[model samples]
Target chain A: MSLLGVENVTKRFGGLLAVDHVSFSVPEGAVFGLIGPNGAGKTTVFNLITGNYELDSGSVSFAGANITGKPTHRIVAMGIARTFQTIRLFSDMSVLENVLAGRHCRMRSGPVSAMLRLKWQRKEEREAIGKALAELRFVGLAAQAENPARNLSYGNQRLLEIARALASDPRLIILDEPAGGMNELETAALVNLIGRIRDRGITVLLIEHDMSLVMKACEQLVVLEYGKKIAEDEPDAVKQDPLVIEAYLGSGDEDF
Target chain B: MKPDADNIRKGAYAAVAVLWILAPLYLDKYWTDVLNNVAIYAALGLSLNIILGYGGMFHMGHAAFFAIGAYTTAIVNTAWGVPVLWLMPFAGIAAGVFAVAVARPIIHLRGDYLLIVTIGMVEIVRIALVNNVFGITGGANGIFGISSPSIFGRQINGVVAPGHYFYLLTVFLGATIILFSLLEHSRFGRALKFTCSDEVAATGSGINAAGYKLAAFVIGAVWAGMTGTLYAAKIGFISPESFSFWESVIMFMIVILGGSGSIPGVLLGAILIIGLPELFQGLQQYRLLIFGIVLVVMMIFRPQGILPPAPRKYPVDKLEKQEVSL
Candidate 1:
């Protein structure tokens, strides 16, 4: 069964339909890619799925459970985690602390228990730290765990964000332009990290402008243009499709 | 070298603790009383830090909770003869409940908008108390005949001497510091910090941002309310003038001047804001001017506070130098 299903989703901002009748499904443990040009409503689709914006129509389901219009945090707790298109690390916090915060939904201890430091709360806290550390290690950020997030280089900051998202123990993780500011080497490392993330049996849904990374990592691809799905198929087929090519290069066949 | 540094720090803490304990014995009654006021202000500052510092809420109405607590204790004790100490927790609860009710709708307002709304809230509370809404507040004349607080069968009489009250205040201040320190490192505290840093990111991480903000508001309110109980018990009286908007402003200043989110910073801030004014009583006319100048100079030179909060750290296993260095 598909782990995520966005059926007939439509969103409008005044007169402009930001996302118009978009439908797609992401199978479990698969690496899926959504690619489009600037203002193609790619990020808007992410916002709608993550409940950052109210959809004008249609519904989203995760793990066969209807999750449309749920609060963003609640949707996250139900096993869907996402990163922002722009990196949003807790700038004042240490890298490990940022990851530890992502473990908040999985932990049960509240203020009272935390204040008193009950045995179970302490145990949970220790385990959370352990898991967060493991995530940092997975992303090769274990050494920089104590550094303030803002002090990390841009590429490392992006990795820190991914580490934070992975700490939530979600079944599905969405990457919104994770390679936005990355250079060639950094993008190559990010591709390897995404492949490793997929090998852990977590479904990956990515929105990227990096055709190289998307074509290399994603099992399937969805092409969007001007708030509509222009093509959906295997990367090879989608890349060759005239509609996808036209969407990217325009009718005049200019280089894109 | 690390062990030596640790020992020096420990020794410093011991010396400070010893000096605090011996203060009342060596000092005059007036000085001792002033020190006690410093402790009270420190507690209040720490309370406000939880909201304004950690939660990143622009809270300028903490005195309302303090007033609620004072009134709760005053009314409960005067009417039912309940000891002020016994009703202290009730005072905290009252303030906390009041905070939940008042902050629920307006907590979503950010920055200056929230600041304005909180300013209005404090005014509303003060006006309510002045008007003696239910006749229980005793109007602007205030309530009196309040008995002294007895802890473990020993009465703490303010008139007798400052020694016992000094010990009492110290105990309360120590407890507040310890509790706040523990909370500052707790999961809940981290949640509040994350919410403050980035509400959207915190929500994306599955943190209930609004819920944590509300928790911080109520916790700060409860602490302020408890401090109010202490203030009432110490003074044996409370008027609308005591919990004025000026008092709220002073509390806010204490957090900002002493690093907003730093516990030690807040304590130092309290001493400077509350204690220094008393020490400079000779320059009465220029008191406000000096304070304003000091604040401006401080803002210009060291805006983060005299003792800025240190970056939070966690224990790591053998720091490895990775291939791709930042």
Candidate 2:
């Protein structure tokens, strides 16, 4: 069953149509890939789904409810959490603190409870710390939980971002270029993590340029070209699609 | 940091705190007065640190809330004859409510825009006091003849003397430090810090960036407002001049100079900022010039502050225990 549905979605910037009437749905518990050439509005599409950008036209529904024009945090609370194309960890904060922040939406303790250290508040905080550390262990950065996030290597930072997103306890996790700048070993680990995330019953929607990883990990794929959806099918079928080939390789008319 | 180093740092903090609570006995009355001022400024600095330091907001109009609190105390006390200490909660509420109203429209602005707006807010508040808005402000001459705070029939004699007010001020400062420290370690504090460091990433992680920003602003305002009551009670008179834009600047500098989010840094900053010029009173006209040079030197030597916030440590061993309990 589809958990997130994007219908006739559109976004524009001044005169440029960043995402033009694109539509897609992410199935529940499936690893979905959003693939397109550079400047194909793949990131823009991600932004629209996560409510980072307002849709110029169209509606997005999650969990059987329309969620168009909601604020980014609200969208995240509705179980759609995403990472940036560029890593954006809270560099000065501890790695553990970074993950705890992801648990922000999940926890209900307020400023008063926090200040007074009320009975339930203390219990909640202790639990949050435990879960935050658990996420760090999941990302294999448990030993560095006390270190500043800036001290992490680039690959570890990517994992940290994932762990942070997962801390929000989202139903659908959106990863943008998670494998970018990763070594072969890191990519393999990410693929394994994606499978693990699915096993946890969370839907995965990712934007990727890594064809090998995408074909290997993603159950289905959506391809875009110049702000329009060109193809949507299984990874094997998408690889053989003529329109996707033209969009990624070159326009076939040029014969280069 | 190593556990031993953390323990040593914590021990040093305890020693300083003990010394601080006991210092009034040894110091002369004049120096005791200086200590009172230091305590008050330290509390105010900690208040602003929530917004400017933890929340990464550029708030320089904190004096507006301070002025509101002082005025609230003056008006309520002068009219109803209520005790000065009794009005602190009222002043904090007034400041907090006003902060919500003021910060609501402008909280979406990022960086320098927010800074400029807050600066304008302080000026507007000061001008309103000077103009005697609502006629209760007593115009440019300011409110006077305010009552001293009393505790269970024991008056501290805060009017025109530091005497027992030193103890009173220390108690206030101690409460402020403890409460603010609790807040700093709280979930609210973590979310605020994350939002400040990176709003986009924070929001994506399901944290409400604008709401937390406004909350930090209001929390800071509420604390500053309570401190205002203390200031008024200490002086027995409050004028528009006391809550000027310069006052706000000094509070901002206190947070930045000490270490934005470090409580100890703010206390040290309050000490140096209030105590240094008084100790170097012989500088006279060149005091500000020397102050500027000192600030420049500080910027070059310790940009992260002399005491930056340390990384938080959690007991990983607890995870095993937590699951078993569950």
Candidate 3:
């Protein structure tokens, strides 16, 4: 059974087609990868699925519900959470507070309740703090929970983003370039982290440039080129696709 | 939260409480009146801090809401012979509803553009009042003979005793601080800060960026309106000149000068912005000039204000920790 399905999704930016008729589905609890060359629109697909951009055509569904054109927050509420290509931590806020902010969607207490410190709000707040800290502990940043988020190291910042996304209590988590600025060791740790996340019965949709990490971490892969889905297969089979090779290494037809 | 930090914060709170309660006793009538005035601005500053500080919306037209609130209280009190205190909620609602209408279309504009529009918003409101759009407003002369708020059958008026007004304003300020502090730590506040920092990331994280911004704008206006009610009752008069563009500027400066998101910073900001010139009254000719230079120097030296909000603290010790997998 699939948890998230993108059917013939398309997105255009004025004159340019950012994502074109891309279609794929992630099986429940599987690690799915969306990979292509830099401009192949992997991030755009993530944006479209997450409702950051309205699909120019087609539709997206999660958990058997058509969520096409829903607002980003609504998409998130329906068990989809994502990280940016560039790390977007709430800098100047404490690391724990950053995770708690992610937990904002899960908590239901409104402004009046919050201001009054109503019994229900306090209960939710206490539970939220516990969950946020647990997320930090999961990401190995519980010790730095009180420090400013921007004070985290590059690798830790990526981990922080994952923790933040997880704090939203999403069943499907999308990560865009989760290992973008990571070194080899950090990438190795991230691969292990993704495996841990998968072990916890959550589905992962990843957009990564690191081929080695993609192949090692993602069980299934969808390859894109020029906004078109060129390949979809197991990691081993995806490596053997000629179209993917040409897209990555070039076809030797264009003038450099 | 660490024990030591907690202790320090508690001590600071107690110290502020003592000072707030004891100040009017030691001060003369003029100084007490100054204290009351500063307290009003402090409340206004904290209210605007929601939009400008946490929401990161550059709203220079806060006085528009303040004006709406003051006028609401004044017009209603005069027309119906109702107690000003009874009209507080209406004043807040009027400003809040107006804020929603005006802010909805323009909330998406960024930084300087939003600032310019808000500036225009206040001017439009001021012009409306000056022209007596509804005829309830007394035009250029503005509304007068507004009643003082009575508390517990005892009249709370600046004329009978500035101390009574001081206590009333301080008590309200205390409530605002308490409620706002709780709000600062709440999910909504966190969401607003997130939206302010990065709308794209915040939206991606399941935050309604436009909704949160609009909510902050309205909440700020509601509080400002209530503060305006207090202002009307204290003065027993309202005028177009009172809620001017410069008043908005001063409120804006209070938030920034004290530390935009920090409550104590705003209080300190109100003191300096409203009290410094009075303190330097002996330099009658050069007081305004000296004040400007001091503010310029302060801004240059401490761009973040006197006390930017400390990072939020959470109880991590209570969480049952597990080892991070290598």
Chain A (alone) TM-scores for all candidate structures: 0.97, 0.98, 0.97
Model 1 TM-score on chain A: 0.97
State model 2's lDDT. 0.90
Residue-pair clashes per candidate: 0, 0, 1
Model 2 lDDT per residue over A14-123, tens place: 99998888999989999999999899999999999988888999999999999999998998888988888999999988899999888888898878888788999988
lDDT of 1 by residue, B50-160 (tens): 999899899998899999999999998889999999988999999999999999999899999999999999999999999998999999988996778997888997657
**What DockQ results do all the predictions give, each relative to the true complex?**
0.54, 0.65, 0.57
On DockQ, the leading prediction is 2
Model 3 ranges off by over 4 Å:
A252-256, B1-13, B321-326
Candidate 2's docking class is: medium
How do all the candidates rank in terms of DockQ, highest first? 2, 3, 1
List per-prediction Cα lDDT, in the order shown.
0.90, 0.90, 0.91
Error of 3 at B3 (Å): 11
**Taking the tens digit of each residue's C-alpha lDDT, what string does model 3 give over B1-326?**
66697689779978978987999889998999999899999999999999998999999999999999999999999999899999999999999999999999999999999999999999999999999996889999999899999988888888668998999999899999999999988888888999988898888778889999999999999999999999998979989999899999999999988998888899889989997779878889998788788779988999889978877767677654533231
Cα deviation of B18 in candidate 2 (Å)?
1.9
Cα RMSD for candidates in order: 2.8, 1.8, 2.3
